[model samples]
Target: MKSQLFTIAIAAFVASLSYARSYANEAKSEQRMNVLFLASDDLNSWLLGDTNRYAGKVVAPNLTKLAESGVNFKRAYTAAPVCSPSRTAFFSGVAPWTSGHYHNTPGANSSEPLKSALSMAGFFKKAGYSTAGYGKITHGWDQGEHWDEKIGHKRDPAPPGAPLTPSGRGEQDWGPIHLAEEEMNDTLNVDNAIHRLQQEHDKPFFIACGTFNPHMPWYVPQKYFDMFPLDEVTTPELREDDLDDVPEWGVELTLGKQKYVDSVFEHGLHKEGVQAYLATTAYADAQLGRVLDALDKSPYRDNTVVVFLTDHGFHLAEKHHWQKATLWEEATHTLMMIRAPGVTPAGGAACERFVSLLDIYPTLAELCGLEPPDYLDGRSLVPLLRNPEAEWQSTAITGLTSKGGPTWHPYLSIRSETGRYIRYVDGQEEFYDTSKDPHEWTNSIGDPEYASVIKRMRAAIPSPSDAATPLPEVLKNTRE
Candidate 1:
């Protein structure tokens, strides 16, 4: 009887140990954070502002709500003001000046040095997370292999509506579509993301949802157009001689695209174009709301990190320019907000310090307690995340190659908290005191008082040797 009782006691002890071990493993799994990366194409920072000039004119309630819940980098700028290069900088943690990928057609493989480098998705996948992406994430380059599961790029069909302008400028045209919202490409992408969020997964997942709205050919339901009536639409503040004080190179860049703006005004489509942009922006916001709602309902909601940013800013006849590719404030500034479950405080906070999109990779790695690649050019934004008012010493850098110009001829711009400085390869320069001239209407490069400021900003640009190699023979002839 005594022997049998001792054996039963030993058996019970072993069973208790097994149960404790199982619970430990489960807790470890639960602690691993999931990542949800959201991206939009050609979204201007002006549209996201509530106190700026365009405030209350655009409707994006979901985005506004998200900003309230996270930390919004109010002055976040892109590494490059173009789609492919900006996205590339975020993924590879390499700046355009370092990779020479100034256009929208180059891929990670295009740069020999980055061929084997792991993208953000690839990094998470290697670390045992299930990674997936949908819509326009990598420009025209195919990053399908980098993701464990990916939805191929989808092109939106021309909406069955009349052209707003007579130019009928292919993808640049905008009109109201006559189809259901469910048929929209952006809506379909959101649906795909929602389905993935609802599925049960044994491992943490990294899901990327990219929306192509307000990009071009802004086609959405007529109801969206109705949101902004023609009479109520407000154009951005424009100066008739905005480019007069600018340098020759700067003036040339503005004049080259003045024709597009001329066409819009000539056809009396300026108000209509602005209306289309606001409407498409609203449509994108609705899709974002759907994804956010799905996540809130999912079990992983408490452990997930959400990041939303635009590839780059868009120009709607601002600074006499109609599109992106210029180094001006309108084209370089973008929207960036991050929501970390426990690290970020509940109430939305704004960080006014200068930050580049290149910091996204290192920021994620630091948040997850993972080691980032040694080649990352951007410093981690973890410090700013922890304390928005912390003293930061970094500057935002942006680069652009002239449209249809030689690859070696690139312009680099650097922005600090107080001023913006631009220098072309040909020795031309532009300087703006952001505090005094927010619209960058006046050039202060020649002012003696700003000589010290210009000297400091000029020192921030990368040396010629640090810039990316020229495009290959096959890609050199490609136009924007």
Candidate 2:
């Protein structure tokens, strides 16, 4: 009888231990914060902060409100200027030079470091959170497999008689479509986010909603276009002789898009294009506003951490270029806002420290009480979030990879608080004192006064040897 009692006691003790562990895990998950990750494609700093280039031109009340509610990094930059590479670099927590995956067509699927690194959603899912993603989180590769629930991105439907602009590049056109707000793809993503917020989640959640508007072929409802009258739209400041002082590669970057610029001038569609872009941006903001509204109404509002950013900035005729892929300020400088409920200062704070999208992985990991993998190249921005005026000793590095000849060329730029230094693959250099020349029209690499500044910036750039991985087979034939 005693032996049978002893066996029953052992079984009970083992079950009790298992229950204790499960209870502890449940409590830990409850204590942790939920994350709401929001992203916009090809969004610039125009509507975000006090120091943006276009101060009052944009009609983005939602973006302004969100910026007012969080720590807005005024100097936030992308890892790369292009969509695919920038998204990959930030999502993988690896630098572009390290991955050697730069273009949209060929991605970093083959990069060993990227393949091993835990994606943002993957990390949260591993930490027992229910992860769901919608819209353009990972650009070319949607990364649907990484999330427990995913709704792949869909582009806004093209209105009848599309190509509002008559450029040969059809996707470059922009105008308003006739679809209802509920019919837009971004609206669908926002609706998904709203529905997720409304659901009763058993565990902490990581929800990502990405908006694809304001990227290209910018089409929204007619009401958005009506918001920005074509006559009232002002084009970005342009220097007619901007290319005079640029390096050969830099000039080539502009010349490559000369056809688009010529088309704009040829058809007198400059102001029209600007109006379309602003309208599309406003449309994106509206979707974000809906998501924010749902969150505000949901039970998880106070406990959820919200992060909003863009994959990269777009160049609307700045630097004499019409698109991204150039390592210039216009293409790299973007908007990044984070609101950690109890941690961030109420009513928003502006962080002027130079930060990169690459820092997001570690920052979210630390914010949610998860241990970050040591392989991440970015440091946690939790300190900056807690204290916006914190002293930061880092500069944001943005790069672009283009094949100039037989080998790929990595164009790199280091952006500091006071200046910017760019180094092309062929050893050509350009340095600008951004504090004095915000437009970066003058290249002062040969100037003797800034020799030490250029030297330090040059030393910070990753060596060509560090870019060991070659572009995937998709990009072998043509230059990006």
Candidate 3:
């Protein structure tokens, strides 16, 4: 009987050990690096450091803190400048030229059918990661349908119409408030993120929180506006002869947005627009701080990775432009800040490699130890992130062509480390020695001295692939 008892005890001990092993494995899987992807609407690189010279225009203490803890990429770009196509390239890891996604519509109309694409979210979900996409996941995808849970009833509905404010058309306000009053609304989105965080999910989370502030009609609490006095707000250096050397193409691109950017020429409107952008940015920064604060107070603080970016840069009366969709430096560049513990070098390590939104997929894939699919157009920026002084520098490309525009020359821009090359497909080109002329006042495209540099920059264009694929058979048979 003693021997029998001994055997039973051994068996019990083995079972206990097995159970402990299973629990440990489960914890490891559950502890995958949760992501807090904070995207801004049309935010540019200039607004981050004193780089844009306007960082002080807004008091974004939270973003400043976040940057203190993370790495802010000084030179980051978008594959395309337009919203839909650029956003599409962000997910597909390729350019719109190849995907047949020229404009916001076409294949990526508001209603799309790709339930499963090479999107980062789809990729993460497939790898046992629980995804939560809130507010503007991408330009093409059904943002609500894409996430496991959405913020509002539908993914992209205007919140229950609140008491509408006056057509505060000309100037920027602190927002969600009025000209006189300084009320605020933080619960709309930041609270939603916190609520999602509180929920219990077995899989690690990939939360994308995109803020629509500072996009247009910049709205924030008047409190934020009070932070930036109008007279103190620094404006873009407005030169009278800014466009003298700019070609017809560049001039056209700059002046085209005159209609949409309504507040540019209004009385002290430029100041308000700048103030509004800063106020909206500061407000968004506060909203982000809430998320970061929550993460710090939660069980997932040390293990989570945070990525903040903007779709593209917004133009506030600069060069007479309001929004993006241009191939200029302001429009082509984006705001990219990442905070991944143990992965990203902290304390404002600036990386100047020519990278686009397309790099996001491979970078995340490498960081998380996942195998990226074969069809992605961008390569992993892991090596560069590891070594800030990475040597392999290539130029990033952005294209611009409106369906109804008079000038048929597709605006193509190549932003390199040393200089910039902008050309219309029809042969008109502008070359700016960014090393010397950062303001891009001089056009040296046809200059004999810079002939070789121009040739090299032009050849940097990605070799045509299936993107150069011929048109559909039905189109071939259609009458012109």
Candidate 4:
């Protein structure tokens, strides 16, 4: 009888030990580094330190502060220059070319590879982290199910008469709305983020806060407008014949949005438009400052990996364009900064490598010790983070979705440290030696002196079979 009791006690003790091991595993996961992903809408590189073209012309104090504490990617470019495709490329770890989602019509969640692939939020949730997203993370939060908690964003309220600037298309105008800063939509979004940061989490968290200012209808409080005087606003450098040397395909993209610029100039809203964008950007920066302050005060400050980036760059009459969707520097060059505690440098660092938003997925995965999917198109930027001057050889590729149907073919832009090379489907090309012609006023495609460079860039274009995924038959007409 004593021997039988002894055997039962041993079995109970062994089971307890196994349970303890399981508990320890859970605790380990809870101790992992947290992630604070911040995104801004329609922001350009004008405010990026050491890479700012509009130095002292834009007021983005919070963005400047964030860059001072993290690694600022001076030459970051978007995978696609449009909103839906750009966001989809980063969050889905799939490029627009692969997904065949070149436009904003068909939701990315409905697309194939994006539909099946594990998203950035999903990957974190699977790795035992609590994922929460506020504001515009994915295009309309199409993959909303991945988050343990999620909140969608809304635009700033319009004034009584609306369309304050009296130019441009739907939600294209910009001015100060007669509202308090706290009453703004972005402030409310940041409120949710601050609340999440204050709460106690049993496990590490992945929090994404996105602000939608500096986008269309750039509505913010009157105080933000007061900060940027209209007379002091600096307009982008422009040439009367900027497009005279551009290829037919490039000209087509510009003409589509030319009406907006024409209307602005006709109505004399040029300075007001520039002022509104800067004011709206400053307002967005203020909202971001709130979240950053909250993080600094919270316990997660020491361990959280904070990343700030915009979906894509906006064109403020640069290249005679008013908005995104072009493959030019004004449309594709964006702001990207990462602050990984103990991983990135103390004060800050600037990396000049040609990186893309597509790299964010793998970089975050590797930083958090999570396994990235095999199908990711971007390489991890860990080495660059460790040493800002690391030897890296990579180019950023931006694709413009083609108009659908039998003759549909996507346009490709390859950006390297040397220059930018754009290739259209008809074999027409445009090459800009950005080193000498920053405004890209001259197209060097006809110059025989750069023939070898053109050939090398042309070879980098993906093959026809691997290029664009054909848009689904049903959705092609909806957009094109």
Candidate 5:
């Protein structure tokens, strides 16, 4: 009887050991999924396949192809209209208002509250993943410690050309350069990213490639410019009275940057400027294609989760605006696409639900089976990835501080599927029934019929106390 009992105990111990080994193997497999983050600067949603009017007008075959493979968000918006604040929101999983990173102030990661938070890269690094960043990931913030390897502020040589217009906005100038595509900064960045992908790694990798093209100065190769002829190039539909219904503060914001509009018209470079923007966009697209192709040929393509997005949208003479920093659709709406290896549905579907750049952090964390920090203000997008038609109730909020002195208040815009509502700090409001007026030409805030809609949208805006303190006067009035 003693021998039989000893034998039974040995069998139970062996079974327990097998279970432990199985669990360890499963965990390792879970950790092996890689993340490839691709970012663009100042890329508007209208330049891609999101809108019917611009569809097939822009030359972005790779982006279109990538969209076909995964889920594209049709109505993704940035937390803020500028670079630093928008990127800060995504990286920290916190909104600009909550973090008080409303301006182009760099080193936001070192700020209060966010100083203790685990950045997107930091969180992945802590989870046994190798992280590397290239190009302009953060707006001038030195996040060198967050990555295992980092290449910061890489830029391409200025295109070899003369001034098209004496606007003095050197970076805003656009022309064709004489340099080869391979010699461009974006190409070099992609080359480095591809090299990393080709190497075998002991741990999964989180590679970030931020391309800085089409951002400003629109200088690219002549071939790209040739793609869009001066005569055939189409500009965003503009109405002379588009801003007629805008509030006084909103009008002030537009008038503050009237110089750019004046310059564009004064030099007869409107179509040329549009052409340059298109050329730069194409150049960015080519760089994207190269990087994506490298990944496809690499061994880890199947196990990687690819996310592509722009920092924020750009305004190419839309609403009489020349650049970003507006709550209008042209400035806040951006391009967001995710190609999660297993979670996303096949055939490149699109989710029209209103989503924010802030959601990217939590969505990526959840996709990799990691628990996102509790302080995140955005919701996980896993449900939408699983089913594009998933029931979702969310609105995208974008904020901008007016261009006045220290006394100016910030304006917040809440974007829903049906309409967009803007509430100024002084209680002045603007509402657009987007279902009828897609361009927001008319502000219907005074209409009694939509009082309930205004009430609902107003309720969504976070209280002023939850927002970060107003940026100092020195940091105010600066253009993005």
Candidate 6:
């Protein structure tokens, strides 16, 4: 009895000492980072030198400057093809399959949002940081009431083209614009974001400014449209038989339910649509410059951690499809850039490891010295940022669920460092190799040469499926 009492007394003393030590450290670490999260619409890694900065592509000068001062994640991917799920994953630190959100929608899914305070805005609030979101916060909603404060912006001033509202071909009267700038519907999101950032706040904050240029309704100001003339632009090449070598599942996805002005695609939209997308992208990049400008002038500039990404990717008649919603590189692959006070490497170093957007939470936690909840699906990326050349896990997964219309393709695909695997619900499949076919033109589903490869990728689907809507039937027939 005497020994027990002695032990209890000593334990109490140690606990008190530990608490004091923690308190002391917390005081010193109070200099936490302010987060400046820049989310652009439909942006992709290919545009930002995430993997390789192509010689012919337009360089994002501001983004390049950011890379010079931070690390760029080359193989990073979004959780879903559209905006909502991707943003949800980042805010919630969870994947779409688990969150019951795989499309760009406004409300809660059957499951809680990936991050549960209903949104990431709430997460920051609980951590004692002021949270503000501008631009596209939820897919359709402006900043939510959940944020400590919310503001919004919209791109263009005109009504959506005729195609979207009345008849599918109604917008043909507006002449033509590329895919990106056409979505400039309204709200002056950039200006609102800047205004919100300039407002005084009681604590360090999480400021998310989304740029809409690259989403859809890809219409840009006349000034930016003139910057890239159709004559000087060369269409990114496509092989006439690009789909021949690809698996049926892969080819099937590239074909979908997109309509052009007056049903003109069968006649011709490749020229009018594709080049406009390129131009619109250039304009979007310019808007990004605006947000960065705001950050450069803000009081929190020195202490902020800036992370940028797109919801997913777009398909401009790539597989013969004009909209988003697929598991291919053009749909799942994305751009992610992060610059923190003392953590990111300089000179635009590239991290080739496959990382999911869900990693954003833990990575920010590491940089800010905060504790992350235990249920997150992504691991911290601090190590990868520090050493971009280090070894990492081989594959990154992406999910897709249709919003509406015919669902003919696979919903889940696992992209390895060098290959891709598409699995359908009814046992169909598609596969590709990055080394031999960067555009995923060839389908080798039943090819004997790739049987072992198929076997390996097939083994990767998570033991317990995270999504209920399995891959579609047409996609399955393409599998080996």
- lDDT tens per residue, model 3, 1-480: 999999998998899578546634654564567788777776666556544534445576776677667766667788777677777777656455444454564445422213224677777777778888666557754434446765531222222233122324333222445432212333356677877777776777888777666565565566877888888987776656666777776777667566544444544466666776777777777777887788778777777788787777766666667677777777887877777776667554767677777777877776666677755666777666666676666667776665433222356678887578877755678898877776666778777988888898887754323343433321222212
Q: 211, model 3: CA deviation in Å? A: 0.3
List pairs with backbone clashes in candidate 4.
none
Any residue pairs clashing in model 1, and if so which? none
The clash tally of candidate 3 reads: 6
Q: Give the TM-score of candidate 6.
A: 0.80
lDDT of each: 0.80, 0.81, 0.65, 0.81, 0.79, 0.64
What would the per-residue lDDT of candidate 6 be over residues 272-321, giving only the tens digit for each residue? 55555666677767777777788889886777898887777776555655
By how many angstroms RMSD does model 6 differ from the true structure?
8.7
Candidate 5, residues 1-480: lDDT per residue as tens digits? 999999998997798578546634664666667899999899888655545224337888888888889999888999988888788788877676666666574346544646555689988998889999887777744456879888765666665455645663756676767678888788788888888888898888999988898798777888999999877887777787788888887887788567888788787777887788888888888888888998999888888999999988887776788888888888889989999886788777988999999999988887776767777778888779889888789699987775422212568899997699998767989999988888888899999989999999998887544444433321232112
1-480 in candidate 2: lDDT tens per residue?
999999998998899578546644754666688999999998888875356565438987877788888898898999888888899888878777766666664556755446556778888888889999888888754455669889878887778787667763668887768788898888998898888889998889999999998888888888988997776787888888877777888777667788898898788887887888888889899999998888988899898999999988877787778877887888889889999887789979999999999999999887787778776768889879889998788699988766322114678899997598998868888899888788887888899999988889999886545455543322232222
Worst 10 residues of 6 by lDDT: 471-480
Q: Quickly count the clashes in candidate 2.
A: 0
Q: What is the lDDT of candidate 5?
A: 0.79
Q: TM-scores across all candidates?
A: 0.89, 0.89, 0.81, 0.89, 0.88, 0.80
RMSD (Å) of each candidate, 1 decimal:
11.2, 10.6, 11.8, 10.8, 9.3, 8.7
Which candidate would rank higher by lDDT, 1 or 2? Answer: 2
Better of 1 and 4 by lDDT: 4
lDDT tens per residue, model 1, 1-480: 999999998997799578546634653555567899998889898765642335338889988888888889888899888888889889877677776667764444566545545688887887778988987777644446668778855767886555655844768788778679999889999999999999998988899998989788888998999999888888788888887887777777777678888888888887888888899999998998899989989998878889999988888887778878889888899999999887777786988888999999988876665667776778788778767888889589998776644445678899887689999868889999888888888899899999988998988787544444443321232211
lDDT value, candidate 3, whole model: 0.65
TM-score order of candidates, best first?
2, 4, 1, 5, 3, 6
10 residues in a row with least lDDT, candidate 5: 471-480
Question: What count of clashes does model 1 give?
Answer: 0
lDDT head-to-head 2 vs 5, winner: 2
